[model samples]
Target: MVMRTLAASLLSIGVIVTSMQVSAANEPIQPIKPVKPENAELVELGKMLFFDPRLSKSGFISCNSCHNLSMGGTDNIKTSIGHKWQQGPINAPTVLNASMNLAQFWDGRAKDLKEQAGGPIANPGEMASTHDMAVKVIKSIPQYQAQFDKAFGSKEVDIDRVTTAIAAFEETLVTPDSRFDKWLEGDKDALTKEELEGYKLFKSSGCTKCHNGPVVGGNSFEKMGVYKPYKTDNPAVGRMEVTGKEDDRFVFKVPTLRNVELTYPYFHDGGAASLEEAVEIMGKLQVNREFNKEEIANIVAFLKTLTGKQPDFKLPILPPSNNSTPKPQPFE
Candidate 1:
């Protein structure tokens, strides 16, 4: 009778262990959803505007110059080259899954993508175009006038409407259905054993504390180095510039880790050139733990699994500017 009782207990324990393992296999991060724009016409107009170089004062730079959709929604440069080859202060973050961020930009200064759109246009180092000039340039185009009318139900092409439409299109740039996402959806075999081990280590080592959620790390602001100071020549004081708070000096928005494999040259300073280096640096700075070479490789393997499906859309054909349209002043 004791032997039978022992066997039954062992069976019960096995069942319990299996149930827990199955539950843990499920993901905490949510999958990206297909975008359904309220105004498809507006999205179309925004797409044209997004690709049009005429929006810049120089007429040489467009939104796509830095945020190239063909290249992981980033220029893949350490820092962006702006108007007249002016170097930007920080690295250009990927625009993919940007709408998933709690706020836009590394500093989190802009509340949304719409507000973020207007900054570079006016920044002297960036597009170097005043809001009024951008509006005037767009207005000068007859085709743009018709598009504006169709999009907003009025021919009034203003910065607000322009940014609104741009933001609408940007909202559709979600990347979904990565291998990690597939594993998250309960496809047990979606990830390799090494990748699964890396994920377990990633969580066990406390990466998930900051990198959890749909976009996997854009939800909040954190200091660049929690355990040690991050050394960089970049003069940007991070969130301190935005909030003017002393404690917020090193604080910056946590970039999303989705497609991190593609958005290389990591961090605001773009210091870490490879995934392994970035992982090691992050582990050392954030958690005060130094990841070994094998550990770094495992983490990188897991990170590569985060690459999702890129947005698929035809290149937009921008409306032509008429003779009355103000010509771009690239040198001036």
Candidate 2:
């Protein structure tokens, strides 16, 4: 038997596969739809751009370095280590259904993927390059310059085209074919009885208030400690840092529960280590009740059901050998 790697542990956080519940009371939860292959050629081009390390200051790290599709779209670190091995203050969120979010990033700083894509590449702690530097680096290679023109009709590659290509690729990263989706589609026998019971406990426990709907999350932002503030001497200034509003302090986007099984070290801060412990912490910090071991176990089981399927794409063979001058190495 193959031993479970970080991927398995991330994917098996709970016990069963599950789906979003739609009711008459409010808007239906809709998982992000897969991007139409309307332009298969562009998607393919975007795919290469997405994987090409040439976009980064460090030749070694592509978008995949932090957001591995096989690894729940996150590298499972509390905070991302960027260029020069510098640590980002915020947790690395999964990129799985990020296109659905109204704002991207833990602090809700970015307005769209096109906007979000450029953040890390130039963050002082991340890829660390100016727009001019990045454009110049990518354009140094004739192949990349040609691909840029092909992808965006721009012989002169700029920050806009680069981020657009990456964002276009991200729009295609939706994962919606989990067993839970199958169950939602009328496959009554898809989930086991225990898993079904766990789903009940998940809702009754009030997890669904903030965690319901498709994409499972990605709809709204809520303060972490709704009932009571999470105790911290130096809590990460979540939404407040962005909005500069005291009321918005500690607010965070409710993350999609899709593939929650594989994206553990849960919560905005990644303080919860195990599913049970995470549940325990949520109850105390947010829900105001201690979780019984079995209930916690069941909730974990239901969360597993949210692990949807994703399609694999081929990685780009690099050295960007076809290109002329190599892009500047961001992390090197």
Q: What is the C-alpha lDDT of each candidate?
A: 0.89, 0.74
Q: Which ranges of candidate 2 are over 4 A from the true structure?
A: 1-32, 232-235, 319-332
Q: Residue 75, candidate 1: how far off, in angstroms?
A: 0.9
Q: What are the per-residue Cα lDDT tens digits for candidate 2 across 1-332?
A: 25457446545764223323322234333433556756555566667766766666776667777887779998887777777788767778898878888789877889998899898877767766667776777777677667767766667778887888878888888887677666666566777787767777777777777877778777788888876677654368788899899998889888888888888877777776677787777877777878888888887887788787675777665435434454566435
Provide the lowest-lDDT 10-residue window in model 1: 16-25
Best by lDDT: 1
After TM-score superposition, what is the CA distance of residue 325 in candidate 1 from its true location, in Å? 0.6
Tens-place lDDT per residue, model 1, 37-63, is: 989899999999999888899998888
| Model 2 residue 43 CA deviation in Å | 2.1
TM-scores of the candidates in the order shown:
0.93, 0.86
